[model samples]
Target: MKRICILLILLFIAFNNSFGQQVLKKGFLVACGDDKLFIIDPNKSNNNHTEIIWKWVVSEAKSLPAEYIPLLKSLDECKPVMGNKKILVNSSSGATILVDIASKDVEFYAKTPMSHSVDLLPKNRIVVANSTHPKGNSIELYDLNKNEKVLFTDSLYSGHGVVWNPKDNLLYVLGYQLLKTYSLINWDTENPSLKLESSWRISDKSGHDLFRIDADNFLISTHNSVFLFNTSIKSFTDFTLLKGKKDVKSVNYYPKNNSLIYTIAEESWWTENIYMVNPNKTIKLPNLKLYKVRKAI
Candidate 1:
C-alpha cells in the first residue's frame, strides 16, 4: 500500500509539472488597446501572487496582416471566442474579426461600427452588438460564410453585450437598460430566424458583459453593480461588485478554479484593472486599456 501511494504521488507531481510547462510555453492571450496583444504566463504562489513568470507580445507589427490594421489601431475586447479556436476581437474602428490561433491569420472579418460585443455561433454565424456613436441601439447576426451579410437585426436600446447560452438554447442580449432573450428557431437551416422570447428592464443606464454561471443563472456587469440573473424564473438578484463611478467592462467565470474574474476601467480610460471576486484578490497587469478576461483552455 505504501509503494502504491508513493507511485500515485509521483504521477500527480509529474502531471502538474507538465501542465505548468505547457502554460509557460503558450501562456494566455490578452488584448490591450493600441495593437498590443500579449501571452501571459501566470504562476501560483503561497501569498499575494502577482508575478507573471513570462510573457511576450503576439500581435506585434509583423504578425498583423494589412487587413487587420484598422482592428489593431483600436482593439476593444480580445478574448478567445467560442470553442477556444479563434480570438474574437471588437474594435472601436468598427471591425469584428476572428483570428486563427495557430496560423495567426485573420480568418474572418466584418465592419461593425460602434460594435461593443460579439458571440460566435454555429454555421459561421456571429451575433454582434452596437452600443453608441455611429448607428447605435442594434443587435445583428452576420453570416461569415456568406460574404459577411446581415441575416438578422433587432432594435434594442444601446445594445452592448451578447451571449449565446447553450443551456437554455437562447441568445441573451443586453442593451442600455434592458435584457432581451430570443429563441433561435430553425437556426440550423438556411431560413434561420430569431423569435423574441422575453424582454425586461435590467438596469437604469447600460449593462456590460454576461458571464454564464450555469444553466439556471448567470452574472451581469453594469454601470451600478454586478447582478445575478436567473434563467429559470427570469429574475435578477443584485450583487454590489462595482461602485464609486467605475464602469464595468467584462466579467468571466473560471470553471476549473470555481472563481470569477472581472475587469473595470475608468470612464476616461485611464486604468484597466482585474479582480478575482470569489477569492477577493487582484492580479497585477501592465498599464493598458483592456476589455475581457478568459481562461486559457
Candidate 2:
C-alpha cells in the first residue's frame, strides 16, 4: 500500500509538470508575402534552426478558385481563430480568406483591396481592414456563410487593423492617425450596420497594427512608435520597449511574462526575420518575405 501511494503521487506530479510546460510554450503563425502561412515552434529546432510544424501555401487550398490565386499574393495577416483550428489570412494584394488548419480547405474568402488585417466577429461575421487603394480605405464587414459578398461598409482612411473586443462587445479599428470603436447595430439580421461609438486621434499618422494585450488594454503600432492603449480610460502610453521603433508591422504580447513577438519592415514593407524579447532571440527565415506574426492561440 505504501509503494502504490508513492507511485500515484509521482504520476500526479509528472502530469502537472507536463501540463504547465505545454501551457507556457510559445508558438506563432507567420504570414509570408511569398504566399505562404507557417506555424512555427520556437522551442524546437529543426534543420532550418526553427521548426515549422505546419505550413500552408496558396496552391494547397484546393477549394480556392484559380482566378483568385493572384489576389491572395503578398500574404500579410494570419490570425488564428476558433482555438487555432482555423486561421484568418489576408493580403495586401487583395484577398481575405479563412482556412481550415487541418484540411487546408478554404472556408470563406472575399476580395478586400490592400487588405492588411482581419478579425472574426460574433454571429457568423468577419471584418476586413482595407488600406489605401481605390476601392480600399474602408472597413468592410461580411457574412461568413455567404462568400464574396459585402454586408456593410464604412470609410476609414488607410485602415490597417481590425480587432473585435468580446469583453466590451465592440469593434475597434486602427487607421491613419485614427482609432475608432463601433457598436454592432442589428447584428442579428442580414442588413446589419455599425454605429460609431467613439473615436480618438493617435499621436501620429499611419497607424499600422492593433492587437489586444489584455481584457482592458490593446497594443497599437504606428509608423513612428508603439503605444499601450487602455480601453477603460481611453488613453495611450508609449510602450517603453518599442517606444520609438519605426515601421513596426506587427506586435503580439504575452501578458503572462510580458514577452513580445513582433516584426519590422526591413525591406520596404516586409522582413526576413521575426523578433522576440524576454529571452531575446531573432529567428531568421531565408527566402521568405515575412510580414506579420501572431500568437497561435
Candidate 3:
C-alpha cells in the first residue's frame, strides 16, 4: 500500500509538470514615447496594477552615447529577433539599436532620419524604414558590424515598415500607398543593395504598419483600416476584427491561440492603452504614450 501511494504521488507530479508545459506563455513588448520598452503580462496588468516583467529605457542604455540619447527620443518599435534571444528597436527620433536580451547590451546601433521600423537580414545586415524627414523617405541598409555607416539606400516615399520574409526570401517594405518586395543583390559582397522585384498598391493610402501573420500573409495597418495581405495570392483583405478601426498604430496576431494585441493612436500619434482581443483585456498604462505592441516571443 505504501509503494502504491508513492507511485500515485509521482504520477500526479509528472502530470502537473506536463500540463504546465502545454500552457502558452503570453506576453507583449510595448514601445513607448518616453523612450522605454516594456514586456508585460496583460492578464495581470492594468492602470492600478503593474506587471512589467522586463523593461529597457533607451536613455539609460549603457552602450549608447550621451549625445545619441536625444536622437532616440520616441521609442516606436521593439521587435523580438534572433529566436527571441535579442530585440530590435528603433524610434521616430531617428535611432535604431539591436539589444541583447540577457546582457542588456546594444549589439548594433544606427542613426537614420525618422526611422519607424527595422528588421534583420542575412549576413549581419540590418534594414531601416525612414519616414518623412529631410533625410527620410527611403529604405536604408546598414551593416551590424559597422555602426553609423549606411551601406545602401533606396527611395521609398514615406516608408514606415519593413519585414523579412524567409519563405520567399524577399524583403517586404511598406510605404505610402504601396507594398514592395526587393531581392538582395550582391548580398555576399561588400557592395550589397536591394533590387526592386515587385510592388503592390495598398488598399488605402498612408500605409502605417506591416507585420508577418504567417508564411503566406502579413498584417498591415493604414490610415483607414487594417488588412491582411496574402503573399501567395497578392491581394489585400480587410482584417475583420479591426475592420474599420482607423488610426491603428501597430498590430500583432498569434494564429496559434487566435489572439491579437494592438495599439491605436488615440491622442495624436500615441495612446495610453494597449488592447487585446479573443480574451478581451485592456491594459492601461496611464501617461506612458504607448506607440507599438509586439508579442513577446
Candidate 4:
C-alpha cells in the first residue's frame, strides 16, 4: 500500500509540472500559403516577427504520391484536424488531402477544380468547396465513415468558405457575392440534408474567410474588407482592418487565449509581403504569403 501511494504521488507531481511548464499557451497557428505550410507559436516567438516553428514545403509533398503531386500547386487552406494531430489541406488544383503530423502520411480524399476550403463536420463528414470549374462550382459533402463518398451537394458561385457552427446548428457557406446559412438538422441520420435558412449579400466581389467571434457573431473576410455579422440582428458592420489594401486573406480567433492571427498580402507572395495582425498591431515577416491561418487549440 505504501509503494502504491508513493507512485500515485509521483504521477500527480509529474502531471502538475507538465501543466505548469506549458509554454505554447495560445497553441500553434498553421498558416498555409503558396506551396508551403508553416507552424507559428504565438507565445514563444517574437511579437515583432514571430518565427515559424515548423514548415512543410512542396518538394517534400511531391515525393508522397502521384495523386498528391497536384497538392504542390497553390496550397490555399490548411486546417488542423483531429485535435491538431493531423492537417487537412485544400488546394486550388482540385485536391483535398489529410496529412498526419507525425508520420506525414497523406490521404487524398476528393478532387475538384479549384478546391478552396474544407470543414470537418460531425460523424467524420468533410465538407468541401470549389471556387472554379463549372462542374465543381458547388459545395460537396463527403462521408469518411468508410471510404470517401459524396453525401450531398449544393450549388453556389465562387464557393470559398464553409463553417459548421454547433452553437446554432447551422452551416454557413460563403460565395462570391452571397452568404448562405443552412439548417443542419437530420445531420446524424443516414439521409441527412441541410436546409437553406438564410441568405445575405456580403460582398460584390470576393468573400474570403469566416471566423466565429461567438455563438451569435462572426468576422468575415473579403477582398474589400472584413465585416462583423450579427446573427440576432441579421446585419453586417464593416470593420476594415486594412485601410488601403484589400488583401486580408484569413483571420483566426482563439477565445481561450484572447489572441487573434490574421494575414494580409501585398504585391508579392513572400512573407515579407505579408502581415500578421495581432490585437494592437501587425507584425511583418519575411516569408511566404499566408492564405489561411488556424489556431491549433
Candidate 5:
C-alpha cells in the first residue's frame, strides 16, 4: 500500500509538470511562419522581440512524399490544431504527426492518404475529411485510441468541412458543396441520413475555413473577409475585417480574450501578417513578416 501511494504521487507530479510546460500564461504567443515554427513571448519589458522558446523548420524543400508536395505548396489550405501538450499537423503528405512542445520532438507519426481536412473530436479522435479516386469525398474518423485507424464514413462530397457540434453530442459536417451530421463516437448518421444536405452552399468556389464559435454562430472566411453566421436565420453578418487586400487566407476568433487573428495578403498566395482586432475593431499587432505553417492541425 505504501509503495502504491508513492507511485501514484509521482505520477500526479509528472502529469502536472507536463501540463505546466504548455500553458502560455502571459508572456508568449505561438507563431508559425514559412518554413519555421516557433513560440514568441512578446512582453520582455526590456526587449520587444522576446526570446524564441521553440522552433522547427517545416518545408517541402526537404525530401517529402510527392503526394504531400501538393498539400505543402498549397499553403493556404493547411490548418493546425492544439492537442495533448502537442500539436497535430496534417497536410498532403497524408501524414499526421504529434509534436511535443516541451522537447520539440515528434511523439508519433502515421500516414494517411491526402487528408483534405481534419476535425478534432472528443477522446483524441481525428475526424478526417477525405476522398479516394472511386470512393469520393466522405468523413473518415481516426481513433487515436488505436495507432493506425479506420474509416468512419463511406460516402461524402469531395469538398466539404467536417465539424463537431459540442452543444449536443453530434457531428456537424458542412462540405464546400454539402452539409451532413453524424455521431462523433461511431459513424452513426441516423439523424442526418446518408447523403449530405445539398440544400446549402458552404463556400463559393475557393473555399475557406469555418470558425466554430458559440452554439448560435459560426465565423467563416472567404478570400477577402470574415462573417458571423446565425444558424437559426441561415444568414451571416459580415465582420469588416482587413479590406483592400488581394486575398484573406484564413481567420480565427478567440472570444475568451476578445481578439481575432486573421491572415491578409499583398499577393495572391503569400501573407502580410497576423492581425489582432479589438473593441473599435481595429487591427492591433505590430506588422511583421509571417506565413502559414503549411501543415494543418
Candidate 6:
C-alpha cells in the first residue's frame, strides 16, 4: 500500500508538471457566468484562485437599454478566443461581445437571437446557435458593418458552438442536440451555398462545444471528456480530463504559447480555476482538470 501510494503521488506531480517547474505564466483564463467574467491564474496557490480581473456592466443604457444587452451563459465563451487576448461573450438575450485583455477594450459587439453559444468567423462576423427546443436549427451570422446580414438556418436544429476553418471557408459546429460541420463556400458564392461535409450524430448532449486550434486541428469538449482531432488525419487519440462530468462547459486555446486553456465545474464560481496544459507531460491526477495539456502535434 505504501509503495502504491508513493507511486500515485509521484504520478500526480508528474501530470501537473511540477518536476520541471515550467508552470504556465503570463496568459490567463477568462470565464463568464451570471453576467460576470472571471480570470484565473493556476499554479499560484489553491488559496489564491481565479479572480475577477475586470467586468462589464450590462445594465440598461438609457439609449440602448442595458436591460436589452444580452447576458452570457457559460464561462467557456467568456474565456479568450483562440489566438486572441480578447474574450468572447454572448448574452442570454442574444448579444455578442469581444473583450480585449490588455487594453480592456470591448473591441466589438453584435446582437443576435442566440441562446447560449456564439462564434466569430474568419470574416470578422459572428455566428450564434439557439438554446430553445430543436426544429429551428439556425446559425445567425451577424455582420458588424451593418446591424444585419444573412443567417444560415437550414438543417441546423441546434448548435453548441461554431468554429472557422481558416484554411477553407468552413465552419465546425457542435450543440446540445447535434454535431455537424458546414463549409461556408456559399458565403461568397453566387447563391450563398453551404456543404454539410461531416458530422457526428448527437442527441441529449449538452454543453458540447467545438473549438478550432489550427488549420488541420480542432478540439471538442463534452460533459465528461475533451477530444483533440486532426482534420488532416481525421482520427483522434485524445485526452480525458478528471474534471467533473458536466460538459467541460467551455474551452479556449492560446496561440501565443501553444497552450490549451480550460476550466472545470466547481461549487463556487471562484472554485472553478483554469489550468494550462503541458502537452509534454503524460501522467497526471486521475480526473485532473487542466488546460493546454495536449499531445505532441
- The most accurate candidate by lDDT is 2
When sorted by lDDT, best at the front, the candidate numbers are: 2, 3, 4, 1, 6, 5
Full ranking by TM-score: 2, 3, 4, 1, 5, 6
Q: What local distance difference test score does each model get?
A: 0.67, 0.87, 0.84, 0.71, 0.50, 0.52
Query: In model 2, which runs have C-alpha deviations exceeding 4 angstroms?
Result: 1-26, 45-48
For candidate 4, the 10 contiguous residues with the lowest summed lDDT are 268-277
How do the residues 122-216 of candidate 3 rate in per-residue lDDT, one tens digit apiece? 99799999999998999999998998999999999999999999999999999999999999999889989999999998879898899898899
Better of 3 and 4 by TM-score: 3
Q: Show how many residue pairs clash in every candidate, following the order shown.
A: 0, 0, 0, 2, 10, 22
Residue 202 Cα positional deviation in candidate 3, in Å, after optimal superposition: 1.5
TM-score versus the correct structure, for each prediction: 0.77, 0.89, 0.88, 0.80, 0.65, 0.64
2 or 5: which has the higher lDDT? 2
lDDT of 4 by residue, 1-297 (tens): 999999999999887655433322246777777777777766555546676666777566522556657655788888887767667888886677776565455654566568888888887778888886877778888775533467788887888888878888788888888888987657768876677899999754687777777788887777777787888899988765543346567776545555567776565532442234454544444545556677776
Q: Which is the leading candidate under TM-score?
A: 2
Off by over 4 Å in 3: 1-28, 46-48
RMSD of each: 8.0, 7.4, 7.4, 5.6, 6.9, 14.1
lDDT value, candidate 1, whole model: 0.67
**Cα TM-score of candidate 1:** 0.77
Worst 10 residues of 5 by lDDT: 279-288
Residue 10's lDDT within candidate 5 is 100
lDDT by residue (tens digit), candidate 2, 255-274: 89878889999999889888
Segments in model 6 whose C-alpha atoms lie over 4 Å from true places: 1-26, 39-46, 49-52, 60-64, 70-76, 79-86, 99-114, 133-136, 148-150, 186-193, 202-204, 236-238, 241-246, 253-260, 266-271, 275-297
Deviation from native of the Cα of residue 277 in model 1, angstroms: 3.8
lDDT of predicted model 3: 0.84
Residue 261 CA displacement from its true place in model 2, Å: 0.3
